[model samples]
Target: MLQSYNFALSVVLLNVIGPSLSNCSVNMALGMWQKLQIFLAFVQSCSNPFDIVCPHKSHVQFRTQVHCNSTRPQYMCLYDENKKQYTEVCVEEAETQREGYNTILRGGIDGVPCSTNNYQPFSHSSNTGGSCAIVKTSCNDEGQLLYDDGSSTTDRSCRCDYRVGYDYVTVPSNKCFCKPAIEDCSCYMKYCDVNQVLTQDYKCARVYKLTGIFDCPEVSGLGSKDIEKNKKMPSNATKTGIFFVQIDYYQNKDKTYHGILDLILGIAIGMIIASVVLLSTADILNVVRLKYSHNDVIHIVCNHVETVVLCSIELKCHLESTRHCKFIYWTKRINGDISTITSRTPGIHGSTVTYPSLTLDSPLIEDCGEYVCCAVYDYGRVCSPPIRLTVTGDVPSFSVDNELHNTDIGKPVSLFCKIYANPPCSNVVWKKYEDGQYTTIHSDSIDCSQTKYFTFTLNLDTFMESDSGYYFCYATNIVGTSKSKCITLSERKYAPTIEVDVDDNYCFNKINEDVSMPYTVSANPPCTSVVWKKKGDGTSTTIYSEKIASSPSKHITRSFKLVNLKEKQSGEYFCVATNEVGTTKSQSVLLYVAEAEDDDFSSDENRSTVTTLPHRRTRYHSCPSNWETDYYPIKRRSRLLS
Candidate 1:
C-alpha cells in the first residue's frame, strides 16, 4: 500500500514538472546509496499475506516446518491425504479418528475424513496417563453449550462471554459458531429494515448483516441466546466456521469516491485557470505601460519689495513632450479684467518655463495687484491660482506745524493730519498734551486704500479751556508708525469788544468846523492795533498814532476828529480793534459837513445883523459828563463838545 502511495505521488509530480526537466539527467545523477535506500523502503513496505489472513494463529508459517502448533498437549491419530499415511499429529491438526469420530471439528461439527455424511460428537482427552473418553457436552436452557467434562468449567452458559469483535450465530442445523462481528451492522440493518423489513402494513423484524462482503447473507430474529453461545471464548481467539449475513446497504449518491475526486479536480483546475489569468493580465498591463496625461501647472511667486521688486512666474509640466509650449504671465485688475504680460518674458527650457522677472525700480502703491501665470501647451492652457502682489513701504509722509491756534468759545474746529501709506494705515490716534501729561483724545481704525491718502481729523464740538493743549496725530500701518508734528491749540479767552459813541446819528459841522466820534475798546488783553475807516466808498484812512492810547483798564476810549469839514469827511466813520485773540469793529457813525446859509436882506456889512444860524455841532463822549465829575473829579476829563 505504501509503495502504491509513493508511486501515485511520483506520477503527480511528473505530471506537474516533467516537461520542464525532460532534457535533464536528474535520475543518472542520483548516488547508488540513494537508489538502494529507495529500494529498501519499498521492500519494507510490503505486507505479509499470512499475517493478514490468520493474525493470531502460528500454523501458517513463513519459514518453519512444524506441522501443528497448538496449546493442547493431547495426541490424535489422523490420516494425511498429502502424505498418504496414518500420521500422529496434534489434536488441533487431526481431522478424524477411528470409529467415525473427528477430533478436530470443522464448521463447528464433527465429521469423518472421507465419509460425506459423517456427523459425530466432538471430544478432547488429557495426556495425564488416563484413558480418553467422550467429553459430554450439554445445552443450557438457552441452547448454549455447557461443557461438564472439563475440570475448570462452570455451568454458567447463559452469560454471553464472547470477544468484543466476535458474535455467536446459530446455523440452519441448530448448531452454533463464533464469527467476527460485522462493523457498522446497525447502519446496514437500518437500510434493510427501512426497505424490506419495515413494510407499509407496519409488520417489521430486526435484521443483522455483514456489509461490503460477497458471501454474507442477511439474518433475521437472532436472539440473545445465540449471542450467549460464544460468551466463553477468549477476546483474541480466532473465530471460524461462521458466515456473516450480508446486508444490502444503501449509499449516498452525492458523496461517492468518484464525486469527491471530481470536486477536488474541479477546484484545482479553477485555481490554476485563475492564476494564469492573473499573471497574463499583469504581463499585458506591464507591456502596455498606460499612464495619465496631465496638463502643465503654473506657479507664480510675488517677491516682497521695499523699494524695488523682481517678480517671476514659473511653469512646470508633469509629462515629457517634444511639442513646443508657450507661457504667458497675466495681471488681473481689481475690476476683474485680465491682460497678458509681454515685457520681460523668458524662454521655455524642457518641461519648465520661467518667465523673465518684472523689475519695479521704484514700486509704488499702484504696483500692487493680483497676478496670474499661465502655460499654453498644444492641448490646452492652464493658469496658476491668482496671487496678490503687495508693495509696502513705511508710513507715508505727513506735514504739520508747531503753530498755535486760537478758537473762540462755542465754536467748532477740526484738527486734521494727512497720511499716505502703501498698504494703508490701520490705526489713527489723536493725543493731547496738557499740563505735562499726555491723553488720548480719540482713537479709531482707518481703512485707507492704496490709492487714497487718509486724513485723521479730531473734531471739537465746542471749544473750551480744557481743549487747549499740544495735539498730535499718530498713524500706523504694517511697515511702521509715524507721528505728526505737535500743534498747540488754545481757547480764545476774550473777543475784541468795541463801542462807538456820538451825540447824533450824523456829524453836523459848519464849514471849517471839526466833528469827533469816540470809540470804546475792551478786551482781555489790550488791543494790539486799531484802525479807523470811513463807511462810504470803503476807504480806510490812517489815524494819527498820537490819537491811539494803550490803556491800563479793560476799556479804552479813543476819538477820531476831522480837521476840516468836507463832503468826503462827512461819510460814515467806524473804529476797528484787534488783539491777540481776535478783531472787532464798532458801529459806524455818519459825519455830515454842512455849508452856512447867507442872509438876503443885509449886505456884507450887515451880515452880522442878519439872523445867524445856530452853530450846528456834534458831541461825542466815552462817559457822561455827570459821571466824569463823580469818578474823575481830581483830573479834568474830556467833556462832550456842545
Candidate 2:
C-alpha cells in the first residue's frame, strides 16, 4: 500500500509540472540526489515566477549569462539546443532563490515579457534557442509617452514631445506620453512655452513687454479694437492657452500753432511710418554666415592650402524681395591691408556662385591673415565668420630618398634627394667624386614637389664598373645650406682590369742588374688570384701565383723580377688577375736582354720599348635626389713597384 501511494504521489507531481516542462532532451542517468533537487524545485523554473520550465519535457537545454544592465534584465529560460544551454542546476544555485538573476535580456523564446508574446524571429523548435539580449529602450525615455503597443524585438515608440508644448503624464498608465499643456496643466504646471514662464507662486505667467524696442507698431486695421490685453480680467483666464498681446495709444492736438505744428508733426509721423515700412519690407542679411573648415589656425610650409569663405542666404522667401545676392570675398593680410579677392553676383540661395574659397598656392608667411565672405544687400552688407590662415617657413634640410646605394654594373640608377624648405628652397648643389676627379653632378628637377618640398632627381642611363663612388647633396634656403650625408655605391661584382709597367731593359752585364715587370689589378671583389706568365713557344708558363684583393696593390703593385739579367732572359711576359666575375690579362711587354758591350748601337735598339693603355672614368653620387656624396674621380694610373 505504501508503494502504491508513492506511485500515486509521483503521478500527481508529474501532472502538476508536466505543462511547464521544456521539450529539451533530458540526461536520463542522473543521480538520485539530483532527482530529489528537481523534485524540490519543480515549480520554481528560472527566476521568473511565470516561467516554470522542465528541461526533460521541453527536450532543450538552457544556459544563463545574466547582467542586470541599464536594460533591466530578468532571468529567463531560452530553449535552443543549437546554442549553449544554461544548466538548470546553475540557475537554481544562483540568485534564483531570493535575490533573482542579475543578467541582461535573454535570447530565444522564454516566459519573459516580449519573448513568446510577440515571438517571430524563427519557428519554435527544441533545436533552436537563446534570448534576444539586445539592449531595448522603452518609450518612457526622456519622459516620452507611449502611443502604441510594441513587441519584445522592437522598442516602444514615444507619443508626444513635451518640449514642443506637451507635458508628461506621470501616472503609471500614461507613462509613455507627452501631452498638450492644457490637458496636463493641473498636474504638470512645469511645462511652459518660450513666451510663458512658470511662476513660483502660481501657474505659467505671461512675460511683460518692455518699452521702446519692445513696443509693437500699430496695425492699422486688424484687431485694433482691444489693441492690448485687458489687465482688468481675472488671472485664471490668462493661465489657459491665452497666446496674444495688446497695446494702446493716445494722441492730442493744440490749435495755438496749428499750421506750423501740424507741418512738423506730419513730417515726423510720415518719417516714422516710412521708416517702419522700409525696415519691415527690406531683407537683412542676418543669415550671411561664414564657414571656416578649421577651428584652429592653419599652418603651411610653402604649400598649397585653401580657406573657405562661403555666404548662405537662409531667407528663401525673402530672397525674391532682395535686389541681389552678391557676395564679396575679402582677406586681411599680415601687413594689415584688407584686400578683396573678388565679388560674385546673384548667387544661388543655398550655394555659392562659384567655388567659394581663397586658394593660396605656394604662399609665403606674408600672406598669412584673415579671410571672410560677405553678402551685399541693398541697404547693408553682412560678412561671414572670419577664417585665420597662416604660412610658415623653416630652413632647408635634405634627406636620402634611397635606402640602399648598391648597384649592378650596366643597370640604370635613379637617385632622389628630398628636403622640406618651408619657404621655397633657393638652390641645390650635387657633388661627386668619380673617375679620379671631384666634379659637380647635374640633377634634374622633379616638378612633383617643386612648389612644396624641394626635390631633385639624378638619373644615370647605366651604371658601369667604374661608377662606384661617394656623392653629396647641398640644399640652400633663406636660413642657410644644409649639411649632407655621403652615399656610396658598392659594386656587387666586376671583372678585373689589369695594367703592367715595364722598365727599359738592356742585357746588363753587372752582376746585380735585374729587370722588373710590375702589375696593377682593379676589380670590385679585388681579384683574389693573380698569376705572372711568360709567353713561350705559343704557350705560357706561370712564374708567380698568389691571392690578392681590393687592389691592395693600389699604392704598390706586385712585380715579377728577373735578377742577374742575361741575354737568355729575353722573352714576352705578362700578368693575369682574376675574381669571381672574370679574369683580365695585362699588356704583354717584350723583355730585351743584351751584352753591355753591344750598347754601341742606337738608343732605340738598345732600349726595350714600353707600351701604355688608356681607359675612361666613371661617376657615382647619392643624395636627397640621391645626390649626396663627394665623388672625386679616381685616376686609374698604374705605378711601378720596387
Candidate 3:
C-alpha cells in the first residue's frame, strides 16, 4: 500500500508542473532573442556593446533584462532493461545546479532537469511552436506600425512609417512624431500673383520639404495697395492628410541692399549728369544774348577853341540791321549838374551817328564843362563817358631875361622864358631865327603845378662861328599865344692881326732924343694889351706893355715910344697884341742908332723932322743926299700865321 501511494504522488507532481515549466522556458528563449536584437541595434548606433549594459538616462528604463537563477534537479530516475524495472537515485544538488547553469549561460542545453521553469516538451508532429503572447495597439497620429502576421508589440512601440514624398520627425519625449514634408503644393504662386512681375525680389524656383514645420520665404517690391488688395491670399502652407506644404523664395536682383561705396557712386553719377545739363543750358543762353548785344564805345578827345565840333558816336551792332537808331547829346558841369543838349545837327546812318556841330559863337566860362554822347536804338541805349573842355581869356604872357648872350666857343648855354597866363600855358616852343625866318628848335607842354617857366638849351660840342644866332620862345593856351623877345649869342674874341709902319733909312742920334713906332691891331674884340718887343741875337725882349685904347671897328693903332735912342736900341723891333683868345705879333723893322752922322747932320736941307700923320695914316721921314735910302716895307701879320 505505501509503494502504491509514492508512485501516485510522483505522477501527480508531473501532471501539475509540466505545462508551467514549458511556458517558462519559452518565455526565457524569447527574451534572449530580443536581447540579441537589442545588442545588434546598440552596436550599430554606438559601435560598442558596453554602452547597452550602461545606457544613458534617456534609455535607462528600456535596457534589456537577463535572467540569472539556475534551473537544475537534485535527484534522477534510472531504468534497468534486463529486469524490466525502474529505480530512483540520489544526485549532487550543488554540482548538478552549477553544471546546468553553466550550460544555459553558454547557450547550450544538454539535459532537462526535474525543475518546472527549466524545461519544455517538444512535439514532432506539428510545425507551430510556442511563442510569447502578443497584444494589438495603435500608433501615434504621425506614425504607423510595421505588420507582422496579425500581431504587434503590446507596449505600443511603433516606427515612423510615412507615405511617398513624406517624412516624419519625433517630439522631444519620443512618444509622438510629425509628418511635416509636403508635395504638389503651390504656395509660391499664392504669394506672387499672376499679375505681379517675376523679379529678383519675388522669385520662387526651388521646392521645399521641411521636417518639423512649414515656413515660406519673404516677398518684397509689392506696393501697399497691391498688398491690401491681395490680403486674401494664403501666406502659410496647409497642414492636411499626412503632410504639411512648404514654399521657398529668393530675393530680387534689382532691389537689394546697397553698401556705402555703392551709394556714394550712385550720388556722384547723378551730380555729374545734372551738371552737364546745366552747362549746356547756360551755353545756349549765352549764345542767344551775344547775338543781340551791341559793342562797347571807344574813348575820344576834342579841342576847346573850336566854334563847332561834330559829336560822332559809333555803334557796333551784331544784328542784320539798325534802321531805328538815334543819338542824344548831354553836357555836365564841374559842379555835378547835368543837362540835355538839344541844339545838335542830326545825321544818322546805320551804326554811326554824327550829330550837327555843337556851335558856340560866344562860349562863356559855363560852357566849358564835360560832354557826353549817347546812342538810342530799338533794343537799348549806350552812352560814352564824359569828356572835359577848357576855355581861357587870352594867350600866356612871357618874358626873357636878356636880348643877347655872349658865350665862349665849346660851351653850353640855356635860354629861359617865364610865362604868366590866366589858365596856364598849355605849350611852350623854342625857335631859332635863321635866314630871315624862325625854325622850331624844341617844344614841350609845361605842367602848371610844378612851374610856369620853360627853358631850352644849346649844346656846342663842335663850336662854329655859324652857331651865333637869335633864339626865342613862344607860349600858347586855348585863347591866344605869346612870344618872348629874341636873344643873341656871341662867342669870345679871336686872335688879332697887326701891321707896323717904319722907314727903311731913319737913323736916330745916340743922345737924349725921342722916337716912336706905330702899330695897328685888328681883332673881333679890341685888343686888351699891346707890347713892343725887340728881336736880336736869336732872342726877344719886351720893351713896353700897356693897355691900348680900343676902336669902334675892332681895330686900334698905338705908338710904342722910346725916351732916348741909344746904341743898344739898334736891334729889330715889333709890336704884339694880346687878348683872352690869343696873341699876335707884327713884322720886325730894323732900326739904326748912331752918333750924329757927319754928312746927314751937317746938311741943313737933311735936318731930321718927325712928321705926324692922320689918325690912321703912316708917318714919313726924309733922308740926306749922302745917307742911304734903302726902303723896308711894313709887313702885315696875323696870330694864325707862323
Worst 10 residues of 1 by lDDT: 179-188
Residue 233 lDDT in candidate 1 = 22
Local distance difference test, candidate 3? 0.42
Between candidates 2 and 3, which one is better according to TM-score? 2
Residue pairs clashing, model 1: 161-231, 162-231, 210-245, 216-246, 217-245, 217-246
lDDT of 2 by residue, 549-614 (tens): 445432235555655555554667777888878888877767655444322333353343322224
lDDT of each: 0.42, 0.41, 0.42
TM-score of each: 0.25, 0.30, 0.29
Candidate 3: 10-residue stretch with minimal lDDT? 123-132
Candidate 3 deviant stretches above 4 angstroms: 1-327, 330-372, 375-492, 504-512, 536-538, 548-553, 601-642
lDDT of model 2 at position 404:
55
Q: Name the top TM-score candidate.
A: 2
Q: What's the lDDT for residue 375 in model 1?
A: 44
